[model samples]
Target chain A: MSHGRPVRRRGRPASAERNAGEPATRDRILGSARTEFAERGYDKASIRAIARGAGVDSALVHHYFGTKEQVFAAAVQGAFAPAMGIPDLLLSGDREEWGERLVGYIFKIWEDAVTRDPLLAIMRSAVSNETAAAIFRGLISRNLLERVSAGLDRPDAALRVELALAQLVGTAMLRYVIKVEPIASAPAEELIPRLAPVVQRHLTG
Target chain B: MSHGRPVRRRGRPASAERNAGEPATRDRILGSARTEFAERGYDKASIRAIARGAGVDSALVHHYFGTKEQVFAAAVQGAFAPAMGIPDLLLSGDREEWGERLVGYIFKIWEDAVTRDPLLAIMRSAVSNETAAAIFRGLISRNLLERVSAGLDRPDAALRVELALAQLVGTAMLRYVIKVEPIASAPAEELIPRLAPVVQRHLTG
Candidate 1:
């Protein structure tokens, strides 16, 4: 963490410079943290190392984020920031297409290069670290599951949302970690049409 | 970790009596490793402390497990041993009832005191550590998912099994981690009847 400043107005109090480093320094930490956490994971990603990566003091890292746990929360959130917008795309059309829309949106996010690494890092790290695990699970439940649930008309929409996300998550785990063939390298688009109906069932049926 | 000797072995392995204090020493180290991995998680659990807890040479641990990664794997497998039997159970009954049988078995395992601890430890720790995450994910795909697929009658049973397991895993995560409402404490028989059909659709639908 090479960069340094006394106070962090990090995107809070939108009217001030407090929002200053919120963008650059925060993004800097997030990017580096993404790589570091992915490479070494939570136990190895020390505050000092993250600080060094950001060209900022460790104190500044703490000032911006209250604790290591908070920093992790921010990192996981930033990693998924790109895909977090997918719900809007999903909710845009008729409810019938919702299944395709939701599944396609998720497959696209993992398929794309820019967002893939960070998400993989989050996925890899969260299952092993308690703090990161909590944040990662929460991010999925809140951002993906809860957001998707809001668009569904069914009573079990929330459970369905979780079930759908689970499909994506479980498939990703098999494809990436277990190195399962066929499923691993198969195109996301190919999987979407097949899985969407099931997701849709969870969502509307 | 403590009740020395492999569960299936009729007598202590030759190495057990070679050094009278060794089994106690090994078990202690394994126990400490489990707790450390659980609390600090995989990346954070230090060999130094694990050595102190075991009252043996830290070098001995490295000699046995090779690295932190190996240590984590050993600990998780030991902790998660109860679940490995899932594959066997799924394969035992009539194939048509595999889904219900599998779900009921998992619920029962979680309900029982003996099999519960290691699973809970693995579930929580798997989310936060990479190696543990990999181990957890691998154990599922290799040991659990393959078995589920073998007994399924549907063309997409592979995907469906993945889907069904996702719900179970997510539900387990919430039950163990967040302790979410009555869902966490619900009896196995009651919960299985409700959840098994969803799994049945995944297996044979």
Candidate 2:
């Protein structure tokens, strides 16, 4: 149960460091890597850099995760882990107000203290770094895009998925990455209603 | 990311993506740099490669731009230069259906073969590639953002600027980069009304 070392789950996916437990060294390393990459980008993101942020030895980073790219992938997957339930939360109900609900949900997550900083870091890294962006693209396309698109009945369901993504991600980018005011600080509840219909149009409307 | 498009500006900034109005070699080199840089990104985009694409000598790229960073800086500024007023178009008066108007205007830009493709490459590059992203950030912060944020009467004018940008950029990304179907192929006229209001709200509302 020592947090210094984390055990990887056997027979699990071989991607970013295996999430041994909450706050395990692996998670810690990934978290630090997320911040470093966001701030500096891929070419500048190094094992030593991540380790320094994580307060661990550079060798430990290698031992836990094979490469910086692998670490990046892990960070990205972690970023959206909070919203993995979006499709389920969304599809559980009828088609009405889906957009409002979705936009609100993203805004809420973006506002959460625990998730906000790291998630924004992942987002910036995803766009600002090569390996990180690829990781983000894959993670998003496979996880959110596919699952959400699957729930839509529109002839252009796939297109809708992309639109919805643009709406939500664009909002997040402005609100978080760029730190635009108002939208960044406006109550999440206020945002949800205004933003949801937009999301709904992309989803079911 | 896919290297298929053309170019853009402020009040409309003069761009390197097209020599449409002029056929000068300098213009052609700038245009070629835009495509090559946009497609392959700053790192992968070599002087030699740009020369090939532009049908010029590698020495010429070095001659005009000086170095890759200078070349990248030039390409970015030329591609995303400031343009005339869209908000002016939207903020005409009483702007009840502003959202519809705003969305449509932005969409029109992305739908045209002459403009959409190079923008597609620049945007994708800005997010996923380091040097290009830096160039994009500079272009946006320097030229586009200030103009967009100007003249807003909202309590959160800056936030509105970010949101407005998010809306426009998001629409473009989904429609062009991701090629999200109907949004991509949909008639520009058809898509504008749906989008303008959201943009309108971000602006004057």
Candidate 3:
């Protein structure tokens, strides 16, 4: 399958005659932006630098992603798209194992460098910038908490979901972001069993 | 309480002629560092700025606190002193009620402006800077987790303690820092009961 083209590439090279550029220029810009944002953070990150990193002109970066905020939005969308599937994951399977599955799925991502690095960058940016934090908040709330709550019949389901998430997010912040010992070095399998019940209790208890 | 002092001011100005400045100049520098670190984070925060914030010269700051790192160490000790009381609180309470007490104490600090503001600043700083994060991690591990684990009879106790903390810290990060809906707006009383069980399970289950 062709990549980086969220839109159909049906019309062959109609524009390619004029634009004879790489196939996934947008993806390249995205890749560069991710590196820039992760390294420099939102406030210090620059479009010029991102374009340079992507081996493109600054104008192209602007044309493709518009403002830095828009670029950040796109980056967030790409990074968090899989996490949006969390509600479905939580909804399926026995309700009894939802907590374990939820935590399990999260650690799976955290353990993988490709996914974890961008996430850590976003998390660090959010801590420093209100705009970044707002984006993080909106994504988590709309995609995960709200979706998960919709499946529950209870009134406090939203709060419960957040509490459960707090556990996971907090652990991630400590273990991954802060590199806190024990938790940081402990095997994920050991933690999964120990922490899953706490998550489960949040969901059902 | 003599404000800003970690030590007592005794002797009725025995050496007032030679050292007439306030008795707690050291404490004052520490207080200023906390504000600086919290507001600007570790990288951006400066010794001169912290000194100015405390109404002292840079030399005085250096004289009293040594390196910026030392200032941060002192600031951490001061800022985290209250939280260090957690083990005592956890140990004294009915083991079952420890969760409730733990959550209650945390919410008390998070809800209070005097404490919450500085703590929030420190947390935000810690998220972005490795030095700040290291200070935070060291304090939690040495003061809270290890101390609490010492009280526990069970194995994996340290991991359990970290998990319980993850729940509390994550909730605070989202509710107080990220300010997500429902959990952000929900009364602490409401959250405490719901979150207590999750913490309990991490500690005991």
Candidate 4:
């Protein structure tokens, strides 16, 4: 439930004496992985550097997350953790207001540096590198889009989810990463109203 | 206008004996610049490499486009050249069909590698480098969005133009650059209908 830390999944033995500090160490490795990926990008970043950043041995990092790609994938999963609840949010809310809710939640994530930085890192890597792109693609499709699509009864639900996401993702690229104006400088409140309907239409209309 | 080649403007003198073949040389430099930026990204791309790519001297690259940023700007302009007429396209169409027209036209450009490659290069650079991002922002704002915004009578026309663009840009990032499936493999024909309405709402609604 921690905002930026990797979520420790259930069913792992909780009381093993040797595993006592495993979660913290694992979280630290993941944090280091994010920083490495963010600063060096996917192609240039290395597992050794991520371990060094975490102040752990390379063996420990490898022990926890198998390959460099797996490390990157874990980092991605952590970065996306906060937003993972979106499907639940959508399912719980009135369908009519889903657009406003989706836009509002995503913008909030983007507006905050803690959450935004990792997502931006993931995007920068995905755009320029094939391996990273595939990782991102697989994760978003499996974790994010499919969940949202499952909530929709329509046959084209998956495609519709992507179109709506494309709207938000494009807005984020302009506003945060590329920082284009007037999209970049405009207040989030100003944008939410204008963008909500478009997202709503893509999802429900 | 060549699809991937930089468009030479008319103001430059045509008959100078020393300037014979100037347009070809200039276009060559721009072509080289696009490849360099695309291959190395904005930060690592160099004038020396670009010049070498074009089989010209670095000085010649400097003479044509002053700084790395300037070279990048020219490349951005050229890459965007095909889409530059979008304002006219939007203006001439039955206002109601502008969404379909705009989406259809952009997808055509993206579907073709010649036009899409330079754009992909420009986007890669822009997302990773601040200087590249600014140059891209300035050019898109001045050359593309401003022209589109000018045609609309609404006070919020500029914002609307950007939001609509955000949708397409994001979709392009997902479908082309990142190659996310469902959206990526989905035929343009299938996507255009679903997307055009969202764009129409942003632009005219």
- Chain A TM-score vs. truth, each candidate: 0.82, 0.84, 0.87, 0.87
Quote model 3's TM-score.
0.86
The 0-to-1 C-alpha lDDT of every candidate, in the order given, reads 0.68, 0.65, 0.81, 0.85
* TM-score to native of every candidate shown: 0.73, 0.65, 0.86, 0.86
lDDT of 4 by residue, A76-189 (tens): 888888789888888786999999998999888989998998888888878767888898898888887888888887888888888888999999998898787788899999
Candidate 3 residue runs with Cα over 4 Å from true position = A1-23, B1-28
Interface RMSD (Cα, Å) for model 4: 1.1
Tell me the fnat of candidate 3.
0.75
Stretch of 10 with least lDDT, candidate 3 chain A: A9-18
For B157-201, candidate 1 gives per-residue lDDT tens digits of 566666566557656655555443344555566556655766666
The candidate that wins on DockQ is 4
lDDT, candidate 4, residue A185? Answer: 91
Docking model 4 quality class? medium
The DockQ value obtained for model 3 is 0.60
Please, what are the lDDT tens digits per residue for candidate 1 over residues A67-163?
7788888888888898788678777788788778867777777777687778878765675566776787677667866676677655656655655
What does candidate 2's lDDT look like per residue over A123-188, in tens digits? 655543445655766666677767776777656676666666777777776555444455657777
Clashes of each: 22, 30, 0, 0
Instruction: List the DockQ of the predictions in order.
Output: 0.23, 0.22, 0.60, 0.63
Candidate 2 DockQ score?
0.22
Clashing pairs in 4: none
